[model samples]
Target: MWSMLMRKFRRFPVFSLDKRQWMKNVIHQEVGKGKRVIMFYVDIVKLTEVENRYGDVIAKRVLHIFERILPHVSRQVFEIRGNILAIQKLWGDDFAIYVSFGGDVNEEDCRMLSIHFQEQAEKQLNRQVSFVNREELRVHIGYAAISGQDIVKEMYTSVKRAAHMAKYGITSETYTHVTQFHQVLAEENVTMNFMPIVHLPDGETLGWEALARGPEGSPFATPSMLFRYAEETDTVFRLEHICRKRALEQLRYVKPQQKLFINLDPRAIDDPFLLRGEVFARFEQYGLNPYNIVFEITERHAISNYAVFRKIIEEYRKKGYLIAVDDAGAGYSSLESITEIYPDFIKLDMSLIRNVDVDPIKQALLETIVQFAEKVGCKIIAEGIETGRELETLIEVGVTYGQGYFLGKPDKGMGHASGQAMNFLRTMQEKKASVREEPFLFTPAMSEILAKTITVEKHVKVRRVHEIFEQNQRIESVVVLEEGRPVGLVMRFALYQVLGGQYGIALYYERPVSQIMNANPLIVTKDDKLDEVARRAMTRDAYHLYDVVIITGVEGEYIGIVTVQSLLDKMASIKLEMASSANPLTGLPGNVQIERELNKRIKQQVSQMVIYCDLDRFKWFNDRYGFETGDQIIVRTANLLKEAVMRCGSGDDFIGHIGGDDFILITKAAGADELISFLLEAFPLFFADIYEKRGLGEGAILSMSMAGVCMIPGLYENVEAIAERAAYVKKRAKELPGTVFLDERDCAADETHQTQV
Candidate 1:
């Protein structure tokens, strides 16, 4: 029959091999062509269970039956390998009969063909009498017609996913016959809506949570209904993809500082379609600060596979989008999720805060959750707050942030109910200012000038500056020069050695200048800035070997020593410089102080790391916890830093305040991680204890999240450049499930697997 068909159509396309191989190649090539190619991916339902129950021989026999029955129904086109049979039907099956009438088939025809194939295949399998299969056998079919390599790749993934859904359906006895992929697609109706989570206290609007509405105008508006249908119909992935795309689109319309919370299923992140770079491109086109968009991951479902999901989340987070563990404190592994994902914010489940004030158990639960959040560096956002009593109770419990209808409803447009947040910020700032007073930035040029010229003859006992040392015992070393040249250093050790040793008075009175005087004095120019001179002087190594850098003329004329005491005075002046520019919520300098420090650093040409530290949800914490508790949080954070510096950092590192909850740090790159780690470990201790003392249960503790960006030489235009990058990363960290994000020029430099002490 094959030879006759080939000879009669000699002028037409000819097959080079047997019917099966020829059909396989033809199908493979046809699917490869055109803007869109229909994909029909088929898999046996419960094949694993069938094989285990009936053995491999029975499975082979079933496959053999399929091989023999193909030719009777298929107008053999092509096949890929032995497993997949690609066929263009001329007759027998109704779907194949319809395919013969094709001139670029429409979607309606495609659907009909898919349905027709399932019906014919089922009937054919049922008729086979030789094998009385104990359990009815059916094929789960998935199909997608798409164009472009990207779409094709996505189609391939979707088809495989559809196959799994179909197989799962079959196992449930719901889908007994061959299932068409379009059946699943038909059930998905992508829609979007919004709900607002408002701030309490002053009743200001902060942001809206984007909600997913299933099917046009359906009563099943809750997210559960939408997702349940998706799981039932094998369309969850598609529905999630559509909703995410819509949420990103809606972000453009949201008010510029207000955040938009998008609820996401953990499974949604695993979708290959959503992971494309084009999705991010669309987000960027919407003018969204990915950081401002919060992804709410519900903890209701068991997260069995977190490795891949976590990788996807980390990538998205690095780009600036924030992750929120929603309905936390209610899920089985809520605390575990908090630790694993390190979310920027944990939204307390309504169940935990429903009646926190009256119920000590609920209060204790909330408090524990809040404390856990603090320990992990996550901020708490109380959800489902509906009454004034609840609000007052939350405030008393020291909840960091609150979100509920009682606070504000989610709206379609921007511009929140006013006067609340602004007034609150103003009041807080005033209080902050009252507590902190600015310090004077005393420059050496501005300090009282001391002028004296005392010449030392060749063998003279040069103890002439004993009075200077007596005035300042902090002075560690002094320089001795000869004819406009640095020749020796007079260290405290040298003076004490001579005074107590065997050669005591003999050396002090008779020793020549070269013989007794210590050679190789550290020297500096008169023009060297005070900070630079101070930095060198503070080093014990510099003091012992060559304490000071001698000031010189063009001809190397000896000037004076850059003593350690002078450096200490210089540091004190810089601190005063910082105090002058601060915002009082924190003793740290404000943005203005940052500018000055950056100016000084750039002018001095010193290697420094510009650390931008921001307290995550500090404003909300203040609002809920009262200004006093908030102040304590700030004070505790400052003390943690001071202690951290005392324990881990050398004197060379400079930690400055950038005001409120923001801070600045200038230090060697090597110290960045250590300092950050120390603060991270130490902060929770102080935060927890303060909250405990305030009777904020055990959970309402204060915590901080930070972004530490390394200053790349020439990459930074000014301090603002470093500050901006650091701030951006800190924002990103606050959005993550954790409290600290250290942006060391490149985030990758902070290895994910490596633990830092």
Candidate 2:
């Protein structure tokens, strides 16, 4: 497919020195054929700095990843409008694509296409590659539509001019942040935070890792955002120097015998202060012991040459400092670094530690790493142990040390782990613990918990609503509908408060319900995720703070309502389920967050896919087989979906449970068929064992159903549209027998082991 697409348009595998001439030739040819030409200028923002700092190898690798994903993303984005005539590198880290549109294509069309393509391409770059650092691989795309009057020589120049305007334009976010970045550096506004690293076996504070922050409320306040700007602006070393200096200044709070773990990026390993012995000079002034300092080497910046890195590390070792690899399992080169550096400690990445208690694979991996650490004469420290189960699991796995928000959050002052968590672990070590439930790990949709509240049409008199409220004192709210669609809401408390006032009822008794009803009541469709719904519900002003949320169907028809009480109850259940799940490393986003993200992408008008999933005959299966067996199937379904996504989707793709027997997946439309093919192939096959376990034939087992909504440019404005279509398709999929998928666009059902795509 890629080859075919490349063939359709002239393209080079790499940036060529003669790219300008190549692009000009393509532009001239396309224009000669009566085609209106457009130019796309692509850049890996500040990639030259990356080349200078990390060397050409890393920079070239970044380019290679960028080059690989561009064609695929561009083809998906540009497929709707025009043909990509040619794609070639015109200069260092800057590439151009010549697109041929019809004579009727206007500049506005080109502008929108460029903006959408840029947003998507940038998002793809960050997800497609195992990026070098937390700094995302982002691109700045600028484009120009060639006018018939323009010379071919000016085509490339136009795109470059657009690129310049976009990058340095007064409204550019980078420009604003860069200005803020200068002020931050000039003011020396960095703050240091230290989070406790506990000895897991005893839950004792073993050390504190120093974390840096910019000024509060500034764009660079968050460490990730701060350092990302630093990398882009070529002030990484300068920023690190300042952070290290600030970190050292906090040594006054360091307890004797407790190590102070300082983060040291590989790019900043050779900082001028470090080479000049200035950092060493500050240790004595801070009354620090050399052995009490541990340099936590981040894996974000890959070590290009280990031999040189080993020599550098040895120099630090000679100064009586210890070395530890940070985020050992997350980065591309962490494991290799472990064997090469033989550091004093390895901080297992959160990806490995999240939900480690429940995952046998993670436990096995952790146990293996623990054994290896012992052989290497180093300790294994688990990071991001957010729950007691995780902490206890680390202990059982023989991981001697740990760090995370659960252990202790980074703070201005060094703090200790919660006494309750520590005590719980101690007791569990001596005896078997009871299975206790945490809050629910998954958010429910309104369908799972919507209250059957009374709804009235907008024409109903306010007096009638008041009488209804008075007769049924328990009804806290009423949804006002017009033409069967919800138009407003009336809260009982607010209504009564007004009516209880002198002559309040006589003044407006016969008025339409809309007069007093909250026209802007917090409303969500029944399919919306509850967590996001609750957030929106809570954001209401104090007057309507506890007002019930009006729930509606896709067409705005009033369905029911979820009062504050019901939302809180579901939330409490979620909390309990979370505690009960024995796993705190959650991977799903809340519904609102999911919608927010999907809608943002949808507004870009790029093609994408949203798959709504359901388990066929789930209710019947759960009733006959009981909750335990039903849960096992749910787990299997989740695992299968995850496998499909991991195999066919990019890093940014999403799979989330939308309550009982329902799930949602969002991915690039280009990969939708592949992902669907994978799930169609895997789901029923993986669940065959459950049938055998229940003494039933494979043909009689509970199966899977997926309703896919393929969103095309301008076809679906938001995730809500996708959901609305998916909801319809889901019913169709469920109506059919066995594991099957129904795409709203295709209007065809894919049965078990038979992928339509």
Best by lDDT: 2
lDDT of each residue in 133-162, candidate 2, tens digit only: 557656777665565455554664465455
Candidate 1, position 370, lDDT: 60
Candidate 2 Cα errors over 4 Å, as ranges: 1-166, 275-277, 432-757
Task: TM-score each candidate.
Answer: 0.44, 0.37
lDDT of 1 by residue, 1-757 (tens): 9999775344233222245344434444544653234555444456567668888877766655654454443332211111122333222221111012223555555445445555555556656625555767775544444333354344345455445534443334333212332332444445566665555433445567777765444534566766665675556667777777767777667653467787777866665444445554554455334445778888767677778778777765544457898988785787777778888878889887787779998887777766776566566788887766786677656675676666555544444533443354345444443343332232342122222233343344535434445555876555566664665555555555444433344434434433344443445666555655554444322114234445665567765555454566667766776566655555655666557657666665445666666777688778987988778777777666656655566455556665677666666766666877887777667666666666775355555777766665565777666666676677667776545655654454454535562
TM-score of 2: 0.37
Worst 10 residues of 1 by lDDT: 90-99
Clashes of each: 27, 16
